[model samples]
Target: MRFVETRWDGYGFFLDPSAYLAELPRLRGVLPPGAWAFVSEPGHYDIPRADRCVKDLELAGIHPATDKSGRLVLEFAPNRFKHESGLRISYTGVRHLSIDYEHSIDWMAVDTVLLDEILPDEDGGCVHEIALTDARITVRCRDLEAVWGGGC
Candidate 1:
């Protein structure tokens, strides 16, 4: 799929999915959990399809806490290898959510991060793929916003 560059006010540029995938190998050992698996596998990666797979694996359902009108936020803090600021992703009108953390909260440290938006489904809800250090967060919502320079 072809991805175009879009600008977000508080956030910087969005990475071109194709370009990011190509650069993955060179950035090995520093990739976030989901991305590590993508790079390790052969053949092309399908973002939307992967999102579906994750949702299926978790048997995801709309949480009672989910506000079809509420927002879901996820933050990734920079680690020693990456000196840049942190990242925060917010999804609006969240309809579905899932999180998998491979590390304890106290030891959390983010490395290379990747985010991809899935095609809208019949219900008009969208899904985002968040590949983070030792964690994988997936959400289906109506809108998404991302910002840098968070985490202390």
Candidate 2:
């Protein structure tokens, strides 16, 4: 599975559902417990759906809780990661996670460090502009359009 890390700007990221499902075991090993991992099917951004995603994650052994905003967050002790601003900050924790992207499109984001392995090239591939904020790190698949354009 491909990965990318960028500053949060209130917008989320994307992930390949197939890739994520295959990497669950490996992800479980690397991700710290209690980290908040938000999951959602593209174009279906609703609280109930998000809650359902949390339940799905639980079935896979990755337990997460929904925050007031309906975001599915993995329960864990607070931890810090280096931001583009060069300041360290505390976040929910896990760096990457899997979501059940039942839709034709797939994606997921995590609240963790922006690792070099997922950073896009200087010329720009999938990595968008970096913003220093409390937003979750968005990981998008390079092969698909991460946004919807309003259609059937």
Candidate 3:
């Protein structure tokens, strides 16, 4: 499967459509009242700048407007993987809390697992760490294009 590298800032996860829909109620209970929710295909949109997209959605009356908290909770729309073939969800905000994996780690299992399996010296890539409320998540990947295959 072809997977694209993308960076998602804030709390994000991938879920099968039905599972995601079912989890909404519980998710709301934990998130701050004004927390934003986004559903999109991986690598299809810039997640960090999702506020702009959210504004567009709100203007179109597609979704309700939310406060400018700079933190968003995201889930992959159920059929996203079926359509895209490969899936990935980048995250930024859920730093300290123990992530609920049964609902969140359905599609991005490989990447999430890599967060723990890959080491800094294993690939000579940078290991990025995000301190969550209760734990620290580490991501070891080649940040530079040249490290993988890009320019001259």
Go through the candidates in order and give each one's C-alpha lDDT.
0.44, 0.25, 0.25
Candidate 2, 41-140: lDDT as tens digits: 3311221232212111211112333443222222221121311111111223223334422222124333232221222323332221111122233332
TM per model? 0.44, 0.23, 0.19
In model 3, which regions exceed 4 Å deviation?
1-15, 34-152
Clash counts for the predictions, in order? 0, 4, 8
Give model 3's TM-score versus the native structure: 0.19
Q: Show the colliding residue pairs in model 3.
A: 10-92, 10-93, 17-78, 95-132, 95-133, 96-132, 96-133, 96-134
Best-performing candidate as measured by TM-score: 1
Q: What is the per-residue lDDT of model 1 for residues 1-152, given as tens digits with 9 covering 90 to 100? A: 12312232343324346664565565454433333443334422443343211111211122233444576666555433433444445567777777766543344232334444344435555556654434555676766554445342
- What is the Å distance of residue 116 in model 3 from its true position? 19
What C-alpha lDDT does candidate 3 achieve relative to the native structure?
0.25
List CA RMSD, all candidates: 14.7, 17.4, 17.8
lDDT of 1 at 129: 60
| Higher-scoring candidate on lDDT, 1 or 3 | 1
Worst 10 residues of 3 by lDDT: 54-63
